[model samples]
Target: MGWLAAGEGYEIALVDGKVAARSTSGRSAGKQLKTLPKALRDHPEVERLRRFADWLDRHAASCVAQVDAWMVSALPVPSAVLGEVWADEAWQAALRDLVVVGAVGEGPDATGFLRDVSEDGELRVVNLDGETVRMSAETVTFPHPVLLPDLAELRDFAVELGVAQKVEQIYRPTWDKPSDPNQRSSATSEFAGGRYPSRFALAARAESLGYRVSGGYAVHRIRSGGRMVEARVWIGEPHREDDSVTGGLSWSSGGRHLPLDKVDAVSWSEGMRMAAALYAGRTGER
Candidate 1:
């Protein structure tokens, strides 16, 4: 739903499962998500994804006039010593570039830069005390060495675009037990399956650009007729922000009809609270 809201679509449901466990072959440091499915890779959605990437590139070009260049060597076949190194003029130059990139369309200032030589690779820093670490080409799958400020610029740009355009969220739902019947004494008796109700909603205030949350309302039961999925939501009282009520806090029974494929997740009050908390933490304050 989030992706669709961003004016993009996904062919496959993104599963948050570990595709691979421990492996002798040195690759990623931690477990990674499964690879993209063929359907997703070849879907029309790729075009939309490319457009998103294009936005990043546009932001990058606008934010920074020039980016730093670094030389890197792979591990094991190393010919140089592996250890920390002191700051240098090259580091200062890189740091300046980052500052310029970070402050695009804003003010300008030079932070600090430092360099660190390590066994993994030659770590370059453009800011003081290694505030901004550099990733070389060899370290990342992508050809470019991702810069903190550059990535931040892209994010900022995306938010700006999203807000200005009023993007719609893409909905994708996957249920654990799609065919399971709802339990007795449940609120959703109208439907054949007494299945639990759930919703994966991505909504935010008009002021915000990007969707601030991945929310859901755990359904008591959802009935599928034709293309619509009637979702029965157990409403909680709206959330309170200071004196104002941001969302209703009533536990009243209500229902919403949405596309069958658009359901992102089952919304439970507890789960929604957690998700809201996470969003608040990321943005710093509600």
Candidate 2:
């Protein structure tokens, strides 16, 4: 952004998302000041720039969050919608380089790393064949890492191309349920008995990691195979102040517990991922 005259002799502009000042008639005529001049601290231009910077920060975070939600649910988004938001810097930053799959006809799905969206709503992507392809499909999906059949190969190719995604997809950690019935259960105690200083601390950890705390349990809800399943870990009473210990992780749908064997691949991986993250923050183990 260009600098605007803030006071009699100073100009102000947003630099690195913060208001910065420069003298227009002194020894530092065109050089940015080490710090904002006191006289320009309350200038209208400076205040406006600060507010704009704040809005940009919020907008960027909101974009990332929305993209993350769509990826997690493997939701199919219209190609036109992508074109509509592509012009916005925040939206572009969030959506750029994400692995997208176009639902073309029955031949084979078009999969590639998203590169651009045209004004006419066509998507341009870099395919696995090291070629840029344009897709005009009605809808496209950001499939979950677990659902991508060529996830490992994609990761390798992404590295080769030096691709970096604002929202994690291909590189996100995942787990698979054991095929043996003997290893499957209604709940798993693998991450249980992790000790925290207090119930508040444990709950706070869950919330900080974007999980919900409900009825004394830390819960992660996932949509899998057209149904919603909740994976929860006991975090002790909400009103309790004493030390708390993490408990077993379990999955349920429609208020009925589901065995690990019945849990879908995405749900199982995400559940274990959440449990392990919470347990990693514990002060000790029981």
Candidate 3:
């Protein structure tokens, strides 16, 4: 699902899991309000709109996660698959600007923005020279960074042509799935901000960095000592928003807490990195 901004006189509306503003009669409410009138803001329809907006946001994140998974796995996505997904506006928007190297009969050659997929399943690519090249490959893989042999050259090419990928391309992180799920690790880390300006800012930053938001904590997966554990960073408490002190970062594997020192070097650094980003956004003194 996706969201489209309303034309006029509305906040938001629900459409096939997507959101738009409700176009209704009366004065087209355009002016910004510090606060909304209770009657309108608290209306049942308006509440539904709020819920839809939240769903739309989650859906967008999910899309990013799915694409990231494909890239990480270096999965061979069939041309048909791309065509089907392109039918959805949201998916198309997410994939439009990604770089692809089509697996032609000879080998992977045409590399550029996946401009279009024709009806007969032809991959239309705009090469570095800005020439359109049609390619036919039974399977097209969104190569992992390690697999992109010409990554440096491609980066230089993109820069020369002012080609900016809508989805992250230059620096997409990838990791092998945990090999041993039963491995034990008693690692922990802590993140504290003196205070925060707003919970929204903290949450948005965490989500942007691909952390899962839940129970007022920003949770991310990290591999520590051969174990995959979740690192949870606190956003704030129910009543803590106003004063907004941060201090609840923790690590757990199989529901067991691990001490910060026990965490592996990579995992420990990742946890602190997330914490530092949130802390830097605090409104009060660090």
Number of the top lDDT candidate: 2
Q: Indicate the TM-score of model 1.
A: 0.17
For each candidate in turn, the TM-score is 0.17, 0.93, 0.52
What are the lDDT figures for the candidates, one per model? 0.28, 0.89, 0.62
Candidate 3 residues 1-286, lDDT tens each?
A: 3332433444554554533344344665543334444545556666767786687677776776677556544566787777777766656666765677666554444677677876556778767677778878767766555456666776777777676554666454422223343322211223475466667666777788778887678887764344677777878653344555556567777779876545554454456556666666677875
Q: Sort by TM-score, best first.
A: 2, 3, 1
Q: Which model is ahead, 1 or 2, in terms of lDDT?
A: 2
Q: Which stretches of candidate 2 lie over 4 Å from their true place?
A: 104-109
Give the range of the ten consecutive residues with the poorest summed lDDT in model 2. Answer: 101-110
Question: Cα RMSD to native, each candidate?
Answer: 23.3, 1.9, 9.2
Lowest summed lDDT over 10 consecutive residues: which window, candidate 3? 181-190
Evaluate model 3: give its TM-score: 0.52
Worst 10 residues of 1 by lDDT: 165-174
Question: What overall lDDT, based on C-alpha atoms, would model 2 receive against the true structure?
Answer: 0.89
Error of 2 at 140 (Å): 0.3
* Better candidate number, 1 or 3, judged by lDDT: 3
Model 3 clash pairs are 13-20, 187-258, 188-259, 188-260
